[model samples]
Structures are given as C-alpha cells and as structure tokens.
Target: MRNVLITGGAGFIGSNLALKLVESGSNVTVLDNLSPQIHGDNPELSPLYRSILGKVKFIKGTVESRQDWNDALVGIDTVVHLAAETGTGQSMYQIKKYSDVNIGGSAILLDLMANEPHNISKMVIASSRSIYGEGKYLCKQHGIVYPNARSAEDMKLADFNVKCPVCSVSVELLATDEESKIHPSSIYGVTKQVQEQMFMITGQSLGIPTVSLRFQNVYGAGQSLSNPYTGILSIFSTRIKNGNDINIFEDGLESRDFIYIDDVVESIMLSIFKDEANYQIFNVGSGVCTDVLTVAETLKNVYQSNSSVSISGNYRVGDIRHNFADLTLIRSKVGFEPKIDFLNGIKKFTTWVNKQEIQKDLYEASIQEMKSKGLYK
Candidate 1:
C-alpha cells in the first residue's frame, strides 16, 4: 500500500480524496491547520474533520512551518500538496498572507526535498484555472488570442464580455488548452501559478515525478458553506436557505467551468496511478461553461426556495468573464472524463445541502470588505 501524505487533507477536496485513498488500501496521512474560514471557529466540530477522524493519520499543522512539513513527511511515499489560501478577492487585500502561505509554503516543501532525505517518489499539487486569467479566445480577425484583463471603465458601463486584444471586438470563448498564456489577474492566481511551477520544476530536478492539476471551480458536498470569500455555489445556497435573494455578480452572465468534487477526486487518483501524468500540467474541469444566472436559478429550483434572483450589475476586480477547459490533455494523459453534468451535479449537491444546517449568510459582509478595498464596484 502506498503511504500517501495529503496537505490540507481536512479540506473539502482533501478530505474526500483522503477517504477514497484510504478505501483503496493506501495508508493516508493528513496535515491541515483547519482554518476557521473553511472550518468554523472550532474545527473539531466540523463534519469535514470528523469524516476522517480515525480513518487516516491526522496532524494539526500549517504548511507555513518547516517543522510541520518535517513531521508530515515521515515515511510518506507520495505527497499531495493542497494547502493554500483560496480567496481571489480576499487575496487582493491579504496579499502578504496569500503569498506567504501559497508561495512560501511551496518553496519550503521544494527546498526540503532538494536538501533533505526522504522516500517520496511522486507529488501532486493543486493548480487553479485562475492562473489563466481571461484565458484563450477566438477572434474572427485574430484567429486565437488571449485577451487582457477587462477594463473597469468598460465594466462600470455593464460591458462584461472579454474583447479581442488585437481587434478590440468581442471574442468567442474557446476551450482553454494547457498551453494557454499564464497571466493571473489576482494575487491568489499568481500564488497558485508560482506554487505549481515551483513544484514541477523542483520535482523534475530531483527526479521525483510531479503532476499539477489546474482545477476549475470545484464544488459539491463537504464544501465550506460559511466561507463567503469564495465558492459562489455555497454562498448562494446559504442565502437561499436563509430566505435572502441570490445576488448575481456582473450581469449574471459571467460563466465558469464548474467541476464536481467526485470528478476532481477521480482525476487526482488517475494522475497517481498513471505514469504518463509526470511533469505535466492538466486542467481538471467539466469543460462546459455555465453562466452565473443559470447557477442561481438552478439552486432556487432545486431547493424550492423563495429567494429571488437579483442581478446587481456589480463586478469585482480580477474576476474573469468566461473560461472553460479543453479537457483533451487530461483525457488523453490519464483517461479522465467528468461523469456528472451540471444538472445532475446540482441535484446531488442540493440533496447534501438539504441535510445540513443552514449556515449564516456572510456574503454581504464579504462584499463590503471587498468594496472597502475598492475591488468591488
């Protein structure tokens, strides 16, 4: 059995992945700080933490500490590094915190592997689609182009679509391939980009096979319902449950490639098993773009909630208009195909949410924070 260590293993994705690894006969070790944002004030009371209570070796630690890394690396054959601050808007304000944890923590891991002695053979780090800020697009005149960040001037006028860099006309959304430009609009994206690149480069130099999976908007059961800084699905669910209206951002047309949690876990597992996944970056997403309005309406329908859908024409700085994955690379490399479509995925997600207690709606406070920072319009 492979002795695997998963950093941030108490998180939504990490916990789910840990359970699957344990079920597959792998001895799992989890190192997580249990941030109060994701896991309420008392992490021990979190269902996510409790799910893996006695199943895997759990360590309460942060990735920022060198001692913590050393403690978690003992006897580990494979490492899955998933610890990072994930709030895009919040990262703009908390730049130091994101950089310290995401980039600094990753640097520590790679430095230790370069200098220290260990039995780790393979490593997997979670990269983000955010790395491809305003990713690939098809311009009628320019063929394939990568648009620059949408201007706030245009966004204030309610023009949210990404325009062609060459022609300045609106462009068509293309399936962002693995080779797309690596420009990140937010500090969170920048940190993730640096983190993945460090792991890939360091892992290759050390002859330790590393895989970077650029996951797109992962959501489903076990996701933090109280975390208002990220995960619009969870935020919307909480608001709907509380009888509050669903506030849609950017004309409610801004789209994303939402991949289910199970699909994400399956993709990671495939990368672990397949030798071809080494030293490569793959986009893990549903490959279908679903707009914000559709998501809000779907949740309202699924939960049969009385919450109205409100389009406030508000746009956050560093937010993308629309971008989805190509999926050809991941599919060809590790034979990964997403099983759950949005319709079915929503049903499954809502079913799980129905069983849980309604979390406090912290969405307005998060917006106010961003607004005060001048990131929100």
Candidate 2:
C-alpha cells in the first residue's frame, strides 16, 4: 500500500482516508468529479475538496470515464473504490444514473486492471449494509430468519416491524453477519452488491488481494450536511440548525448500526495492509443498534435546539425496519473495534456542526421527489 488511488477521494470518508494515508507516508492520489450535490456548486471552495487541496495528488474527474480511470491509476499499487450514487430513495427513480456510475465505473476499473498492465496489488471496495435488505432476525418458531421488506399495507396501518418470512411472525433483530442473505431492496444496494461481487471475482483472477467492507450507517464530523437523500445525522443536524422540526420516518423504531468516521477509517486501514483481510468481506460498524428517534433526541439535546422531534407514520418503499452489523468477523480477522459509541460520537459530530454554516432544510423537497414517484406514502 505504498502509492494509493482513492476514487471519490474528496468526499467525507475519502478525505479522511486520504489524510490518514498521507500521514502514514503513502503517496495518495484522489479522483473525484466533486459533484455539486455533495460538494456544493463551487466545488473548489467546498470544505471537503479543500481539505485535501495540497495533501494529495488530486484529479478532478469522474469514474465513468475510462480516461479518468487511466489517469488516476498511474503508478498506484492500491485502490480504495468509494465512488457511488448512495441515495436509497433517490435511486428508486434514478436507476440509470446509479447503475452507470456504481457498476459501470467499477467494471471499467476492473477491466483495465485485468486486461491492461498495471502495478495494482490490492483493492478495497466500499460495500453497504443495504445489500442485506431487511437483514437478519430471530423468531420464536423460526429461530433465525432473514426477513424481507416490510409490506406497504402493513406499514400503512403503522405496523412497521419486520416479520419472519417463514412464519410471518414478528421477529427480533439480530446482528447481521457477513453470510446474511444478499437481497437488496433498493437500486443503490443492488449496485453495491454488484460492485463487491465484480471486484472480488476479478481480484481473485488477477491474483491480487481484495477486501470488501460492508459499512453500516457511517456518520461523524466532515460529512455533508447539505445532502438530504442520505446521512441521517447530517440531515437531522441541518434541520435542527435551520430551526425546522425533525420528522422521522415510520414509527421511529427503525434502528441502524451507527459507526463513527474515525472507527470506519481504522477498519479500512486495517484492510489495506492486513494479509488476513485478503479475499474477505468484513462488516464495519460499532456493533450496537441505535434507533432513529434516539438519534433525533440526541441531536436536539446536543445542539440545545428548540426544534421538535415528530414521529411521522409515513414510510418509504425501500426502507428497512432495523439492521445492525455483527463485528465478529471484522474484529477477529482484522482486529478492528469501534472506539466511540453513539453518545460520544454524536457529541463530537454536533460540536463540528455548530461551527459550520447552517445549510437549508431540503428534507421536505426530497420527500416530495419520492412522493411524486409514488415511492413515498
């Protein structure tokens, strides 16, 4: 991992990763188009892109272009592919954009490495927990089960709990492991699933070490607060800052594994250099489930804001009820464990949010986009 190339290296995770690698004496090169949605209209002036201004060899390009991949791959030994369209609800309509960028871009990178001569020795892809859909659960009669998406009919009646596919009984959430089912409920998740599979297969054929890290809800300082389609922490923070009431989806019991940014970066670092992590898919998370209501309450408390937390019975089509990562595989294989818990992580994130300029609340507009497509009730 001497000379590294990080696709989408100007974003939250990528900028943090690039800084860490540079501190470790690795020559870092970044390839990012600096999308206005994430980086704002003036990308060059955006804090994310400016964070890596002189620290790395930055290339303003997109992964969909083969010439961009060729330019970014020069003399690079390792590739951490983090470029993708990550909005789950938005992906339901923008199927072509997500597929072309996430899957097509990945195909180009692997095709170049497989056919063209390169010094690439290792590859680490950023996979999402969304690939597991409703994730793992335990039922009294079924023992352990992988439930499907909660139905619209059930959700319309305010019954948002995931039921066992085998018995149709309400199931208890379990820590989703690496061997869980691969049925994605959204187009974004499907793209990530394909990206991971393609990388692992091509890497094995090329005789290069490959690792896939199925990251849970990653949030911390430096994340984009302006992006309404993803990153609940950031979205909630933006709403609170604008003095707008925070409206949580569903019954507000939908839980997720919220891992801090530093912990996520550490897991990726371990994967980059560890020999045991080769040809393995590991779950990266804090291993604890935190519900959406708790997140809203904590943010409001931490920010000392008067914004109310409302639990709307409304739900989206591709939303999951609950999912958390089982860290046994990552901990034993890569020796990675999260340091910051939810409370402490939220404190750190809110402190950072306090310093940044308040972003406009676009949550309603985003929801309207989904509602117009009939994906949101």
Q: How accurate is candidate 1 locally (lDDT)?
A: 0.94
Writing each residue's lDDT as its tens digit, candidate 1 over 1-377 gives: 89999999999999999999999999999999999999998989999999999999999999999999999999999999999999999999999999999999999989999999999999999999999999999999889999999998899899988999987899999999999999999999999999998999999899999999999999998899999988889999999989999889888989999999999999999888789998889999999999999999999988898889999999889899988999999898889999999999998999999999989989989989999999999
Off by over 4 Å in 1: none
**TM-score on alpha carbons, each prediction:** 0.99, 0.99
> What does candidate 2's lDDT look like per residue over 1-377, in tens digits?
39999999999999999999999999999999999889876888889899999999999999999999999999999999998999999999999999999999999999999889999999999999999999988999979899888888898899998898988889988999999999999999999999999999999998999999999999999999999999999999999998899998888988989999999999999999999999999999999999999999988988899999999888888988888999999889979989999999998998899999888788989999999999999
Computed on alpha carbons, the lDDT of every model, listed in order, comes to: 0.94, 0.93
How many residue pairs clash (N, CA or C atoms closer than 3 angstroms) in each of the candidate models, in the order given? 0, 0
Q: Candidate 2, after superposition: displacement of residue 242 in Å?
A: 0.6
Residue 198 alpha-carbon offset, candidate 1, angstroms: 0.4
Worst 10 residues of 2 by lDDT: 36-45
State in Å the error of residue 241, model 1.
Answer: 0.6
* TM-score, candidate number 1: 0.99
